[model samples]
Target: MIEADDNENVERLRRIEAVTDAALSRLDTEDLLDELLDRVRDLMRVDTAAIMLLDPHSQHLVATAAKGLEEEIRRNLRIPVGSGFAGRVARTGQPVVIENVGENDVVSPVLRDTGIRSLLGVPMLAGPDLVGVLHVGTLQPRHFTPDDVQLLQLVADRAGLASQARLTMIDRTAALALQRSLLPTRLPEVPGVDLAARYVPGHEAGIGGDWYDVFTLPSGWLGMVVGDVSGHGLQAAVVMGRLRSALRAYALECDNPADALTRLDRKIQHFETGNLATVLYAMISPDREWIRVSLAGHLPPVTASPGCPAELMSLPVDPPLGIGAVQVRHSTVVAFPPDAVLVGYTDGLVERRGELIDIGLDRLRAATQPDDAETVCAVIMTALAPERPADDIALVGIRRQTPAG
Candidate 1:
C-alpha cells in the first residue's frame, strides 16, 4: 500500500509539472494565468482558484485570472495591500489558511458570497519580490494539510516566473507593433524609380528606433530617409516616430534636402531637447537623373551602376539633430545614371562590436553590385545581420529603372 501511495504521489507531481510547463510556454498573460488557475483548481481538487497581480499604480492586488467564480466577482475584485486574504498574503509574502471563512473578518463580502467555507492563500513571489497572490477555496469547511500548502506554494512559485515572462513578452510585442506602425507601410511608386525598404529590430534588443521612409514630394520629387534614434526600446521608438513626422512635414515645405534638414534640426532642438538622432535625407529629382543628399551625422549613401561594383558616395556631414540650437547643414547632388541603385541605411547595417565601421562599409559596398532594389536590400541584410542582431537595422534602396528597348 505504501508503494502504491508513493507511485500516486509521483504521478501527481508529474501532472503538476506538466501544467506548470504549459503555463510558462504561453506568451499572453491573460491566457497563461487563466490556464494556471484552472489547472491548480483541478489538481488540488478545490472548488475554485484565482490569481491576483499587484497593480503598480494602485498599490492593490487585482484579480487577473480566476476559475469557478462569478464573472462580476472575477472582473471587479480589487484588494488593497494588507486588507483581505489575498492582500495579506501578498503584503506579508506568506501563506494564509482559514479553516472556516465565516469566522474570518478579513474575507470580502463579495468573496464570501461565492459560498467558500475554507480558503488557502499563498504569495506568488519572483525571488524576493512579491508578484501577487494565488488562492484556492473549498465549498465545505475543511482543514488544509501541510502537504496541500506545500503543493500550492510550488505552483505559486512557477506562476510568479510565468507571469513575469508573459508581461515582458506582451510589452515587447506592443513596442514592436508600435514601431512598425510608424514606418511607411507601402513605398510609393515613382515614375522612373524602383524603391524597396526594410526594417529589422534587434533580436535580443526587443525593438529600437530604426526607421525608413519614402514619399513623393509636392514638386513631383521623391524624398528618401533612413534614421536611427539615440537609444533602444519604447522611448527611442517614440522619438523616432516624432522625428519622422517632423522631417516629413519639413520635406514637404522645402525643395532642397539641406533646407529640409535645417528645419528638422531646429524642430528637434526646440522640441526634443535631450534626444538626438542620425538622419540621411535625399531628394530624387522627377527625371531620376540626380539626387540631392544631406547627412546628419549619418552614413553616406552607397551607389552601384550597371556592370560595376557598389561604392560609397562621399557627402558633407552635419551634426546629428538635437545637437546645437543653430546648425549649418549642407547638401550635395550626385548623378544618378539609369540602371544604378542608391542605398541608404542606419549604422546597424554596417557597424558591429569591436569592428571598424570601414569594414562594414566595405562589405556593404561589395554586396551592392548591379541588382534590383529588392534583391540588393535582401542580400545586404542576409549577409550582414546575425541570426540575432544586437542593434536595429533599416535599409532603403532605390534603383533608377532602365528604359525599355
Candidate 2:
C-alpha cells in the first residue's frame, strides 16, 4: 500500500530519470528539443514551456524552443540577463518560482499577453557554462515545491546540451557552405600574374573568421584581400562574409586601398557595431610594377623577389575595423619588381600557444623565396601549418611574371 505522498515522490523520481533516458539521447539534435519541451509541459502540467538560450554576442537569452508559448519563439523573444524572471534565473544560476506573476516580474510581453500567472524557472547548465534558461508557466496560481524545482532542473540540464549541440551543428553547417561557395574555386588567369591560396579551419574553434579574396578591377588594377574577424563559430563567419562583400563593393568604388578600408571600417562601425576585425587590402598596378597597400591592425605580408631574401612589407598601421576612423587610415606603395612574390595571411598562421609569434613569422620569412605562386603557397603551408591548429588560417600568394615567363 503506497501512500499518496510516496506515489507523488515516485512520479517525480521517474520524471527526473526520464531526462537521462538512453533513447532520448539518441534522438536527432533538433528534434530532441521539441520532444524535451513537450515532455516538460506534460511533466509539470504547465500551460507553457519554453527554452531561452544565450546569444553570446548580444548577451541576451533568445527564445529557442516553446510549447504552448509558440508565439514567443516566432517573435524571437530576447531577455537580457539579470533583468527579469528568466534573466534572474540565468544571473543567479538557481531555480525561481513565482506564485503570482506581474508585469513588473518579466521583460517579455509574451508572458503577460499569454496571461501566465504562476512561473517556475531553472538555469540550464552545460558543465560550468550557463547555456540557457528553461521555465514553465501556468495560467492558474500554483505554489511550486522543492521537488518540482529539482525535477525541472533535471530536465533543463539535459536540454542545455541538446539545444547547444543543435544550434552549433546548424551554425557550423551553414558556415561551411558559405565558405565553400564564397571562396574562389580556381584562381583567375591574369596575363603575367600567378596566384595561389590555402585555407584551413581550426580544430578547437572550428570554422571561424579567416578569409581571402582576389579580383581584377575594370581599371586593370588587381585587388587582394585578407581579413580575420575576432571570434569563432557561425557569428564570426557571418560577419566575415558581410565585411568581405562590403569591401568588394567598396573596392569597386574607391580606387585607393586606403579609401576602400576607410569605407569598410565605417560600414562595420555603423552597421555591425561591437564587432572587431583586422584587414589588409593590396592593389597592384596593371603593369605589375607597383603595389599599394592598406593595413588595419593586420600582420604585414611577406615579399620575396628574384635573387632577394623574403621580408615583411613595411606599412603604416591603423586600428582594426569598428575602431578606426577615416582619418586614421593610410596607404603605402611598394616596388613590385618583376618575378617578385607576395604572400598575405591571417594571424593564425604565425600565432602559437606560449611561443612568440615572431618565431612563426620568421620561419615563414625564411621558408619563402622568389618563386612561382604555387611553390610559395606550398612552402609556407608546409612550413607553418600544424596538423590541428588552434585557430583558422587563410593564405594567399601572388607573383609577377619575369622575362622568362
Candidate 3:
C-alpha cells in the first residue's frame, strides 16, 4: 500500500504536471475549463467539479464548465457576491473547504442535489482581481487536506489565464456587433438618384474608421456626407459614429451645407481622438437643380450627368478638424441642367498599397467617366479596394432627379 505521505506527494506532483500541461496547451477558456475540471475530479477523487466565471457587470458567479452536475442546474445557477459559500471565496479572494456542505447555510440546494457533502472552492484571479471560482465537490462526507487546497490553487491560476482570454474575445465580438448594428442597412431613396453604399472593415472585424450616411432634409434637400477618422479599429469607429450623428443633427437643424459641416466639426472635436477627421458634405435639392457642397480635407466626389463625360470635381477644403480651426470657404457651385451624380468617398478608395495621397486622387480622377451612379460607385470600389485592404473603405453616391422615365 502507498504510504499516506507518498500518496500526498504523488497527488501534488500529478497536479503540478496537470497545471504545467494546461499552461502549454494554450487552449481557449472553454476547453481549458474542461481539462481543469477533469483533472480536479481525478486528483480529488470527487464526484463532481466546476469552474465559474464572474460577469463583470452583473457581479454574479456563473458556472461555465462542469462535470457530474445536472446540466439544468449549472445553466440556470448564479450566486451573487457573498451569497453562498463559493461566492464568499470569490468575494474574499481565498479558498474555503466545507466538510458538511449539505448542512451549511452558505451552500445552495442546487449543489446539494448532486449528493455533495464536501466542497472546496478557490478564486480564479487575473492579476489582483478575482475573475471566477474553481471548485471541487465530493458526494460523501470527507475532509479536504491542506495539500488539496494548494493543488486547487494552482489550477485556479490556470483558470485565471483562460478567463482573461475568453472575456477579451467576448468583448471584441460584442463591440463589433454593436458597431455593425449602427451602420445604415440600405441607402436612402433619392427621387432622381440611384444610391449605393458599402463599408469594409479590416480583417479583425473591428469597426473601421470609414462611414457613410444619407438622409432627406425637411426642406426637400437630400443631405449627404462621408468621413474618415485618422486611424482604424473601435476608436476610429467611435469617431465615425460621432461624426455621422453630429452631421445628421446639424443637417436637420441648419439648411446651409457649409454651416452644417462647421457645426459637425465642433461637435466631433469634442469626442474624437485627437479631434481629427476628413469630411465632405453636400445638400441636393429635390429637383436636382442645384447642390451646395463643402469639404473638410475630404476627397471631392466624381460627377457625371447623363450624356456628359465623367470628371473629378474638386472643392476647397478646410484643414482636417482637431488640427486647428480654419476658415471654410464658400465655394458652392450650381450644376447646369441639375442632372449630375455626386459620389463622396474616403481616401481608402483611391490610395494604393503603398502610394501618396495625391497619387490616389490622380488615379480616382483618371477612373471617373460618364456612367450610371451605381456603376460609378462599384467601379471605384473595385479599382481602389486593395488586394488586402489595410484600412476601412466607405462610399456614398447620389444623382439629381431625372425627368420621368
Candidate 4:
C-alpha cells in the first residue's frame, strides 16, 4: 500500500514520462522543451517553471524555456555556475531548495521581481555531465518537501537526456547538409580531363570536415583540391567551407598553386587562428601534359600510367595552414601524360588506428592501377576504407584520356 505522497509522486512521474514518450518524439526540440516545461509547472503546482541549459563553452546557465515567468527567456537570463541558487545546483549536480527565496540567493533578480517566494531546483544530468538546470518556483510561501525534490529531479533527468539527444541530432543533420551543399554535384566537363570524387563522413560525434573540389581556371587550367580540417562537427564543416571559398577566390588572382596557398595561409593565420588543416591544391596544364601542385602538411598525390604501377609523388611539404609561424610554400611540377591518372586525397583514406600508416599507403598504391577516373575512385574507397571508419575520407581521381583508349 502506497502513502498519499508516494501515490502523488507516482502519478506525477507517469505524467512527466508521457511528454517524452516515443509517440511525442515527432515534436521539434524547442516544442518538446516547451511542452516539458508546461507539464512540469502543472504537475508540480508551481506558479513558474523554467529551464536553464549550460553552455559548456561559456560555463554559464542560459535561460532556454520558461512558463509563468517569460521574462527569464525574453531577457536571455544567464547565471554563472556556482554563483546563485540555480548555479549552485548545476555546479554541485545536486538538488537545491530555498525555503524562502531571498534577493541575494539568485544571480538574477527576475525571481524576486516575479514575486517567486520559494524555489526548488535540480541539476539536469546526462550521465555524469550537468547538461543544464531545472527549477520551479511559487509566489506563495510554501515548504518544498523531499518528495518534491525527488520528483523534480526525475523531471530533470528525463529532460536532460531528451535535450542532449535532440541537440546532437540537430547539429549532425545540419553539418551533413552543409557539407553536401558545398561539394560538387557534377564534376565539370573538361574536354581532355576525366574527374570523379568521393566523400564519406565518419560515424563519430557529428561530421568531419573533409572536402574536395574541381574547377576550371580563367587560363583554362584545371584546379583540384582535397583538404581536411582538424576537428569534427558543424564548426569544422563551417571552417572548411570558408577555406574552400577563400582558396577559389585567391586562385583567380594568383598564378600558381603556391602563391594561392600563401595568401590563404596568411588569411587563416590572421582570421581563423587555432584552426589547423592540411590542403593540397593543384592546377593541371591546359594541354593536360603536366600538373603544378602545392601541399600544406598534406599527403602527396599518387600517379599511375598505362601498364605502370602507382607511386606517391614526392614534393616539398610546408606547414599546415594556421601554423602561426613564418614559412615558405613551394609548387612542384609533375609529368601527366595522356592516359595517366592522378589521385588526391585527405589522410583519413590511408590512416588506421593501431596499424602503421605506411601499410595503408602501400595498399592504396597497390590498388591504383591505370584505370578510368570513376573506376579508380570506387576502387580506392573499397580498398582503403573500413566497414565503419573512424574519420572522414575525401578522395578525387583525375585521368587524362587518350584518343585510342
**Residue-level lDDT tens digits of model 2 in 268-369:** 999999899999999999988999999999999999987888999988887888874657688999999999999999999999999998899899999888
- Candidate 3 per-residue lDDT, tens place, 1-405, comes to 569989977867877897778365677667877888887788778888887788776899887778886572446778898878888898889998888874554555667665677888899998988889888888788898888898889889878877887776665566466567667887776677667777776553445667777889888988778887776555566666777777888888887877887777676666553757888888877777777888887778778766676666756766776675666645476573545667778876777655787788777766655456677777777777776666667777675545752
TM-score, candidate number 4: 0.88
Candidate RMSDs in Å, in order, are 5.9, 3.6, 7.0, 3.1
> How does residue 13 of candidate 1 score in lDDT?
77
User: Which portions of model 2 show Cα errors greater than 4 Å?
Assistant: 1-12, 37-93, 100-118, 127-132, 137-142, 326-328
Q: State every prediction's TM-score relative to the real structure.
A: 0.67, 0.84, 0.63, 0.88
Best model per lDDT: 2
Better of 1 and 3 by lDDT: 1
In candidate 3, stretches whose alpha carbon ends up further than 4 angstroms from where it belongs are 1-13, 20-168, 271-275, 305-309, 324-331, 334-339
- Candidate 4: tens digits of C-alpha lDDT, residues 1-405: 469889877886686566557755678768877887887787778999889999987999999998987898889999899998989998888888887988788777788678888999999988988899999999998899876787788778878888888777878999999999999999999978888999888875458788999999999999999999989988899999999999999999987999999999898889888899899999999889989999999999999998888999989988899887745789999899878899999888899889998998999999898789999999999999888878998999999988665
Winner on TM-score between 1 and 4 is: 4
**What would the per-residue lDDT of candidate 1 be over residues 1-405, giving only the tens digit for each residue?**
999999989977776675668535744666767777777777778998888887765888877777876452546778899887887787788899988885464556657777788899999888788888898999988799877798889878888887876666766787798898998889987789988988888987768888999999878999999998898777788888888998899888899888988888888888888888899999999888999999999999999998777889988888888888644789999999999999999898898889999999999998887678899889988888777788898999999997761
Per-candidate Cα lDDT values, in order, are 0.84, 0.89, 0.75, 0.88
State the local distance difference test value for candidate 3: 0.75
Score residue 321 of candidate 3 by CA lDDT: 65
Residue 285 CA displacement from its true place in model 4, Å: 1.3
Residue 387 in candidate 3, Cα distance off native in Å: 4.7
